[model samples]
Each structure stands twice: as structure tokens, then as C-alpha cells.
Target: MDEQHERADGPFRARGGPPWRRGGPPPWAPGPSWWDHRADGGRLPWRSTVLVTVIVLAGSTMAAHGRAGDRVGLDVFAYLLLVLASVQLLWRQRYPVVIVYGTALCATVYLAAGYPYGPVFLPVALGCFAAIVAGHRYAAWGAVALLWAAHTVVGHWLYGYLPPPGDGPAAWAQEAVVAAWVLAVVAVSELVRVKREQWAQARVERERAARRRADEERLRIARELHDVLAHSISVINVQAGVGLALLDSDPEQARTALTTIKAAGREALGEVRQVLDTLRAPGEAPRAPAPGLDRLPELVEQAAGAGLTVGIGTGGKRVTPAPGADLAAFRIVQEALTNVVRHSESRRAHVQLDYRQGGLTVTVDDDGPASHAEAGGSGNGLAGMRERAAALGGTIEAGPRPDGGFRVVAELPLAPPAPLSEDSR
Candidate 1:
């Protein structure tokens, strides 16, 4: 029977994994494209290399022409420019500031030397994209702005001609067009960065909330187990003692003690069965009237029956919490009173239950100084009570009272459950 009971309620038998992911592997098993480090950072190094190779070949092809072969000097310069720009791609992410600056510098030099701008500028655009994706938005935009300003300044002063084609109005239009393109890239990159940060923060908050709910659920299970087991165990201990003491002098009384033992065990078995029935399908209707604020009188009577002098008092109106909130309040009071019975040195303790418009407050105070220390050091009773209160967005404070005893005060909100109607159950 004990083995059967163990099998019935063992923690290891609890269901594992979320309902959605219970059957299969997640989608990104092979990993996503953004995290791909292969293909040389998707950099197209061979494009630059081939571009330079074409420039070299073009210069060689034009060697037979007249002063056009002198124009081949420009092709050679473009080839060298491509080589330098391709090298910048390798260190783009690791040293984005250096790479952006270097690319801009080399492009300026190649342009000034009369090198062809088309082949050399391809790597510059790639470098700009790389800088933004590397997680440096502000710096990337700053470098772009600085580069544009330098081009405008240098073009009007150092170079003999304006930066692009046409006179005053057309030239200004071209500059505006280029500036808008640069700003568009910066805006897109910044949007992506902001979205990534928001997503990460939201995920963290969700995980934290899930963990809090899991902890509350675990504490609720523990309270139920304790309420069932502790009473049964205490009764068993009392009866076993009576049986041992009456063994020789009163054999009939010893038999009566054994009968009481059987009755206690049977009661324990019934409660355990009820708990299991409740656990098996939580979606099923509740089997018993939930213990709540109304049950405090009954709880005190039970503690008194267990041989502790428990007192009850009230300072305010009566409280009727929502089903879950009431259950939490009940658990906190139950654990506190149980500790007074099991751990106090003195026989006397007072339980104060206060109900206000704001919330329900329960406080347990014992006249026994060092009751907890004398019985045993710290244990899970107080911790469980605090956890129960916190589960309901409430608070619990337990410590030595001013009157030289232990005190436990718990305040629980009177909020109702969302889906359940107040009149229904």
C-alpha cells in the first residue's frame, strides 16, 4: 500500500515540457543565416579581387593605344585601390571605425589620382553595411556624415571641379540625393538594432514572470501536502505514545490506542486520496469547499484539540477574498499556527485576523521567547508562508515580536480571479 501511494504521488512522475514542444525538435536546429560565419562573412572578396584583375587586364589591353596607355596609369591606380578596399572588408566587423575611416581615405586618394570611381566604390558601400550590422549604429552614421562633409569641403576647395555633374542647382540636387541615401541606410540599421533590443528585453520579462508563477504553483502544492501530512503524523505520534505507555498496565487501553491509530491512518488515507483526485485533473471541478477565511475558527479548534492553547482575535471587518487569494491567506495562517503548536516552548499563542477594505491581514504571535530557537533552528515553515503571500502580490513579515515572542504577519490582496464569476463558486 505504501509503495502504491508512493507511485501515485511521486514528484518524478509529473509531466515535463510545455504542451507545444512536447512532441518534436524546434525549427532552428541548423541555425539561422545571420549567425552564419562562413562564406567570408558573405563579403564578396572575390568581387573586389576580380574587379582589380579586370582593371589590370584593361590596362594591359590599352598598352597599344597612344596617350590612352598613359590613362592606363589610372587603371593601375584603380586596381591598387580595389586591393586595399578588399583588405578593409576582412577587419570590418572587428574594427568598424578603423575600416570605415580607411575605406573613405583610400577612396578619396583613388578619386584624386584620377582613378576610376566605379570599381573602387563598391567595397565602400559593402563596408558601410558591415559597420552597421556589427552593432555600431551611432559610430557608423557619424563616419558617414563626416565622410560626406569632407567630400563637400574637399571638392569645393582642393579639387578644381565640383563633386558631381551640373551647375549650382543640379549639383545641390545630387548632393541631396546622396545624403538621403546615406540617411536611409542609417535609419534602417538603427531600426533593426532598436527592434532587437526590445525583443530581447521582452523575452527576459516573460521568462521572469513564468519563473514566478512556477514557484507559486510549487508552494501551493507544498502547502496542501503539509496540511494533509502534518496533522496525520502528529496524531500517529500521539497514539503510538499512548499505545506504548499502556502496553503492560492496561492491555485493553493499548488495544484502544491501536484502534485510534487505525482511525487516524484511515483519515490520512482519505485526505491523501482527495489530494490525488484533485491533482490528477486540475481542470475538473474542485472536490472540497476550499479552506478560506471562514475556516480560521475551525483551524484554531483543531490546533486546540492537538493540545496547544491557541487564541483568536479580530481588529477589523471580515474578509472574503477571491478563491485563489483566500486559499493563500488560509495557507499562511495554517502554517503559522502549525509552527506555534510544533515548535513553541510556551503553550499560549494569539492569532489575529484583520480584514480591511484594502486587504486581509493575518498575524500569529506566541508568548514563548526563543520558542523557535529552542525547538530547532530555521526551517521551511516561514519561508513557505512568505512564498504563499508573495504569490498573491502580497507580503509577509515574520520575526521576534516586541513582547518577547515570535510573530508572523501576512497581508494578502482582495483581488478576484479574472475568469471566474463571483457568484458562480
Candidate 2:
């Protein structure tokens, strides 16, 4: 009755039953049900149908022979009960508990009516086995207990059949054998139920792990695209404004600004294509090497061309960092310089890089008032810079300077790259 059990049994629906029939399968099948071909290994229900039929026939024949001395022949009513019980097994997968309870009731009636005891109990045992395999644990055990109680009460009143009959030691030994058989069925069913639950839990864990991996990959791609577009587009925007301002008064200056815009547009296009290639074919190597701290001189030259005076400073011996840390450090400086060009009124900017034993520190300062652009414009630039630093276990700070300008500082740990193995080289 649990939701999980219902989902597990979803593949086992009966076909061609009456319109009024709701839960259980129809009494007889005109042909094979759709689920018969899909169950377990396929054709499972068909095989079970054949096996149960054979068992009923062979059991009835043996029972008729065993009671020949008592003149108790196999009667029409006895044959009819055996046929009904065996035929019901074809729907065991769809309605396991229903089949078991239905068959048990029939067997109890036959016994209480003083019919010859034989393989009439075979269908009842088979139904319980089917219920267990379908993950109906409580229902199977409950049916077992109820059937045993019925057998004891009915047999005692009609034929003096108790667990330990009143006849003597011989009768007590027979009852002990029947009790052991019943216990074995219940034990086997419990072992199967435990195994089914373990397999289902393992499948769920695998799906969750796959979803987590996909989410992380998407975030990485988004960060790369943001860095490439923000830095490049900001430069183009500044150059375009300068070209428009000097178009009539200073033709020569306007020509230089237009030239800078052309170069920035070309560079931005190539970088955008590279980022898209990585998304399209992730297994291939990147077309161009990633920019890093070594490219800062070129960056400063570009800013000077855009009419901003920039100065660079360094301290201590230079040390190389792992690829991830190098990329993060480069993006932090690029974003800061982009902000200075687009948002600040200052024309002069100073950048300092300090290399320490523990890590590397970068600071960028510009002499400008804190405009509304710094306070409230879309925060993507600042947010992207912070994300890059945090990914490499670093930190970044950006705010107004006490003297009168804006300042940005970042610290990044220098993680050494792993040495290549002989086989890899």
C-alpha cells in the first residue's frame, strides 16, 4: 500500500479486463496480458502459468491414487477448486496479495468440506511466493498467519487436526513437519524483500550524483563567458565615446580613438569565439592561451591608448602559480581596470603587484569621485570579480578611497602546479 511499492509495480497492469473491474485482474484471461512479456525476464507469467498447471494436474493424479484404499475418488468439486486456484496464478504479479488470499479461502473451503487432501494447497503456497517477490512483505506474512489459523480450527472440528493432534506421538511428529515448512517460506520471503530495498536505494544515489555534476559544469561555463564579454566590451564602449566627442574639433585625435575601437572589437570577437568553442567541444584544447599577469603590460598600453595614464609597480621576486590561480588573478585586474575606464571621471590610474612568500596581492587605484555608476549600475562586473577570487580560495575588496578616489585590492594564494609524470610527458 506504500507509494514506493505502487511505483515499483507500475509495469504490471492487467489487460482486457471488464470495464467495471477496478483493482484486481479479471477471473479468466482470453489471451496473455501486456505485462506478461515485460515482467522480470520476459515471458515470466507464461512460464508460471504452465508450471502451476502442471503442478495441479500431477498433484490431483497422485491424490486420487493415495486415497484408493479408502474408496475416496477425486470428485468434480475437488477438480474445479484445483483448476480455479491454479488459473488465478497468471495475475499474481499485478495482484499478489489478492491472489494469495483468494486461493487460500478456496483451499480452506475444500478441506472443511472433507474433500481428499492433496496438491489443492499448491496454489496457496505459490501465491504467497509471488506476493513476496512483488515486495508485499506485510501482506504475505499476514496471509500466512490467517491461513494457518483457519487450517487449525477447521481440521480440528472436522478431522481432529491440531498442531499436535490428540492421537499420540506419531501425530505430533507430523504436525512438527508442517510447522517447519511454513516457517521456511516466510524466512525466504523476508530475505528477498531486504535485497530489493538495497538495490532501489543505490539507484537513487546514482541519479542524484549525476544531477550535481551537471549543475557544476553549467556554472563554470557561465563564469567564463561573463569574464570574456565584460572586459572586452567595456574597452570598446570607452573608445567609442572618445571618438564621438572629438569628431569635429580634433580630427586627428578622433582617428586614433576610432583605431583603438577597431582593435578592441577584433580582440573581443576572437575571445568570444574561443569561449564558444570550449562549450561546443569540451574535449579539445583551447585555440588561444589564456591571458595572465605577464599580459599586464599590454593591458596598461591599451588603457594609455584610451586616454588614461596608468603606472605599474611590483615587489619581491616573481613566482609562477597554478593555471587556475593565474587565470583568476588576471581576471580580477582586468575587471578593475574596465570599471575605472567606464565608471570613473579620473584620467590617471596606478596598479601595484606584490609577491610574498605566502601569496600574491594586487591593488588598483584611480583618482575620481564616487559616481552613481559605482554605487548603483548593474553589479555584474563586481560580482564576477568576486566569484573568480573566491573560486581559487582568495578574497577581493572594492570601495571608495579615503583621499578621494576608488580602490580595488585582491589577494590570491599561489598554489604550485603538480609535476607531470614520466608517462604523461
Candidate 3:
């Protein structure tokens, strides 16, 4: 079970997904003026603000004309209060906490002056809405509460002393209506705020998934090109040396060496071109099927061209692995034999594949006297093989064997591994 789990350093190590965004600071918290304020990006909602201002100014005038007897008619002071409340909304997004209180206070004064009720409370509703959506719940609730308290005092107790003289106390039924309106406005604002936060989180998740997919694509391409070029180039290097050494004494043998070099070069160019075409237009279908365990004979023939003989064997009932695992097994074997031809004086290598119900095992071995001078190639081949196995819920082992020479064993499960959880990361 442990062997079937992914390694801590696999390519998909960070695939659990991006961390969530931290909640913004409270509105009343002191900071730079712009901190944790705006809702719809940084730009002000100037067009909507201006439109609301226009509608409120006209709507308030119409509403004032319709008030009950003894209610004061619209005066210059009442219109000025309405204008101040409407215009203050321009900065609602940038300073929601300030806007809410500013608009609420304007409405309280307008009512206390005995101005006729109209759409006068619209600006207060908008300011409270903006504040709540900007993550200033306490500020929003307080603004509305203060407005309610002031309105109750003026209508019930202070009516004897203030504005449009000879008016009696407000009815109990009217207070209940005002209370219901308050609750509705607050409840609606809270619902909208929640939806906006959910949408923002979803956008962040999409961006993280795109970046993760791109990283995986780059890694897969790097491994495929490494395996393709390394084996082909190693074969060409050996054949070229043979061709040059025998040009005078054995023309027939030298011709065969040159022919092998051509074949290896053609194969490398073809594979490299396939990789480039895939990059150029990712949506295009592949020109050829990916090589798999069935292609081990090609590796054997290529090794022969490099003057090394490779033996192949299989054990247990043969069962076909998935496309990805089959490709990984093929690359591991090719890389191991490439090492044998390039860095070992031994002229022979052996590859074995063992099939089972749960997984497939690949092993490559050689009898060797190490060629120390050429043993210092970049270690990407082994790392790539390890990545491939681990990517498929498998494990890899590669090192010098006890008696002599190097060996590599890969265990690739039939199923892919699940991504690491956030806690695991």
C-alpha cells in the first residue's frame, strides 16, 4: 500500500489546489485609506452612482408632493439634504463605512426637519448595501440601527418640539412597518455579500488549475524528448566511430555503420518533430501512436547498431497495461539500455517484464566494468523514469547491484494515483 502511494517530491506534489483567499480586515480597522474597501475591482462605480443620484433626486421630489396633511412641503433646505445624500454615494465603494454613516445621518436630519417622506431613504439603503458587501457587516448594521433609533425618537417623543407644528405622536403601526423595512434591507444585503464571496473563490480556483495543467505538460514533454534523443544519439555516436575507423580497409562494413547512423538520425528527427508539432498546435491529433512495451524490439535493434546486445524476457500471464503505464515501462527500459551502451564496457544487457493482477514490474541489468570517464552524464534520465512511475502510483529503484554493474527496477500500478490532499501537502 505504501509503494502504491505517491512520493513527496513527485511532479504533482502541489496538485491539491491553491489556498483560499484570506478574509479582508474589518472596515473600522485603521490602515491606509484604500485597504479592504472596494468590491467590484478598484475602479469606482461612477456610472451606477450617478444614475442612482439622478433617480433619487427626481424620485424624492415626486414623493414629497404626496405626503399627508401637516407634513412640511419641500423647501430649499430639504432639497439640499437630498442632494448631499445622493452625491455622497460616489465614494461608497472606496469608503463604504464612511458613506453608510454619512448617508444615514443625512436621512435622519431630513426626517427631523419634517420633510415629506419620499424616496429619501434610497441613498441610505444603497450605502448600507455597499458596506455589507465590502465586508463591513458591523459598520453596515450600526448605520441602519442609528438611523432607526433617531427616527423613533423624533416621531414619538420630539414631535411636540420640532417641525411642522401641531403634529401628534406617530402611530404604533407605522413603527412596525419601519422595523420590517429595516430587516428586509439588511437580510437582502447579507445574501448578496455571500454570493459575491463564493464567485471570487471560484475564479481563484480556476486560475490555479490552469497553472497546474501547464506545469504537468512541460514535465511530460521534457521526459519524452529526453528518452527519445538520448537513446538515438548514443546509437549514432557508436556507429559513427565504427564507420570512420573502417573507411579504408572494410568499405562493406563501414557502409552498414553509415546506414545505421542514418536510420537513428531519421528516428530522432521524427520523434523531435512530433514533440514540436504537439507544442505548436496542442489540439492536433498525434501523427503516430505512442511507443509501448511492444516497441522493445526497436530498442534491441538500436542497441545492436551501437554494438551492444540486449536480451528481453517476460514472466507470469501477460496483461496489457494502460497507455500511460505502457509508455513509462518502455522508456525505463530504453534509458537503462542507453546507459549500458554509453557508460559500460560490457557488450550485453538484459531486460525483464513481469506482469501481475495489480501492477507490472520492469527490470534492466548488465554485467559491467564501469567506464568512469563517461559515467558522469546528467542524471535526468533516472529522475524522469522515477517521475513516470510515481505519477502512476508506482516506485522506482536504480543503483549499482551487489556483484557488479547497475540495475533499475520500476513498479508501475495499473491505476493512476490520487492527488495529495491539502493536509498532506
Best-fitting candidate, scored by TM-score: 3
What are the lDDT scores of the predictions, listed in order? Answer: 0.63, 0.70, 0.83
Candidate 3 ranges beyond 4 A from true positions: 1-47, 171-173, 244-254, 415-425
Estimate candidate 2's alpha-carbon lDDT, on a 0 to 1 scale: 0.70
Deviation in Å, model 1, residue 179 alpha carbon: 4.3
Give the Å error, residue 361, model 1: 7.1
lDDT of 3 by residue, 235-335 (tens): 98889889999999999999999999999999889888988888888798888888899988988999999999999999989888888898899999988
- For candidate 2, list the clashing residue pairs, or say none: none
lDDT of 2 by residue, 1-425 (tens): 00111111111235433322455432222212324443333334767777877888787779768876442466787777777888888877767778888788877767655555677777877788777767666677778777776666655453544222342222545556656766788787667666665665565454445444555455555666666666666676777778899999998988998898888778778877887888798699998987788888877877777677889999888888777778888778877887787778888899898999868898999999644553322457777778777767788999999899999999888894354553463
Q: Give candidate 3's whole-model lDDT.
A: 0.83
Model 1 Cα lDDT, one tens digit per residue, 298-415: 6665565455677888878775678878877777777776677667676678888788896888888988755444433236667667767776778999888787878998988889
TM-score of each: 0.57, 0.72, 0.83
> How far off is model 2, as Cα RMSD?
9.8
lDDT of candidate 1? 0.63
Off by over 4 Å in 1: 1-91, 115-123, 137-146, 158-180, 218-232, 251-321, 343-425
Clashing pairs in 3: none
Ranked candidates, highest lDDT first: 3, 2, 1
Give the winner by lDDT: 1 or 3: 3
